[model samples]
Target: ITAKGKPQISTMRVIYQPQQGVTIVQWQFEQSIGWLPWEKLGSIMNDKILGPMMEKNLDQLRRLIEAETSSL
Candidate 1:
């Protein structure tokens, strides 16, 4: 998804794969740094924000899956 009022921005793509007993969530980040000096901004945002957010989302998914599986 594109953000508001920004030309050079970052976007994320997510995919999920069902494994034998677990699900793998893949997060891909794409950043557009046209005419930028370095990739520091992109790296910092991924490391600080995206990484933690993905981790939390995965943890929540795991809990929900486990709860449903236990009920079945």
Candidate 2:
């Protein structure tokens, strides 16, 4: 909630890059809208399929968001 008592949604994106062999992750949030709402979300990615790296990144993201929100 904000000072005006409205709710907000936090968004996250997980990206997987192959060939070069690495992954990238990003996070963002929505705040103070007059009406429209956005969904708070999570996602996963992998080089070939939903494999180890994907799972690992997803787990890390979950932990990160959990820890961040828990403090609020």
Candidate 3:
């Protein structure tokens, strides 16, 4: 899913996920999303500097996870 872009930089990735037979989600959680280092979803969700944002983020993630696991 990664690719090269400029002479020295890489092209950003734009991820997509399908739901109900349609594309319903798109996100890029990489630290490359900002000025920080590269980080995927899991580590970012548990990061301390972003602890405040995590409360809300994790809650949403929990809801999504529950919806996936329990159809709730």
Model 1, span 12-63: residue lDDT tens: 4444555654455555555544455455666577578777887787789779
Put down candidate 2 lDDT per residue, 1-72, tens digits, no spaces: 776686656566777789876566655444445533332121222223434655677689778977998999
| TM-scores of the candidates in the order shown | 0.55, 0.35, 0.29
Q: For candidate 1, what is the TM-score? A: 0.55
Error of 1 at 14 (Å): 8.9
- Residue-level error in angstroms, candidate 2, position 19: 2.4
For candidate 3, give the lDDT: 0.46
Ranking by TM-score: 1, 2, 3
Name the candidate that leads on TM-score. 1
Selected candidate, larger lDDT, 1 vs 3: 1
Instruction: Quote model 2's TM-score.
Output: 0.35
- In model 1, residue pairs whose N, Cα or C atoms come closer than 3 Å (at least 3 residues apart or on different chains), thus clashing, are none
- Minimal lDDT window, size 10, model 2: 38-47
Instruction: Report every candidate's CA lDDT.
Output: 0.62, 0.57, 0.46
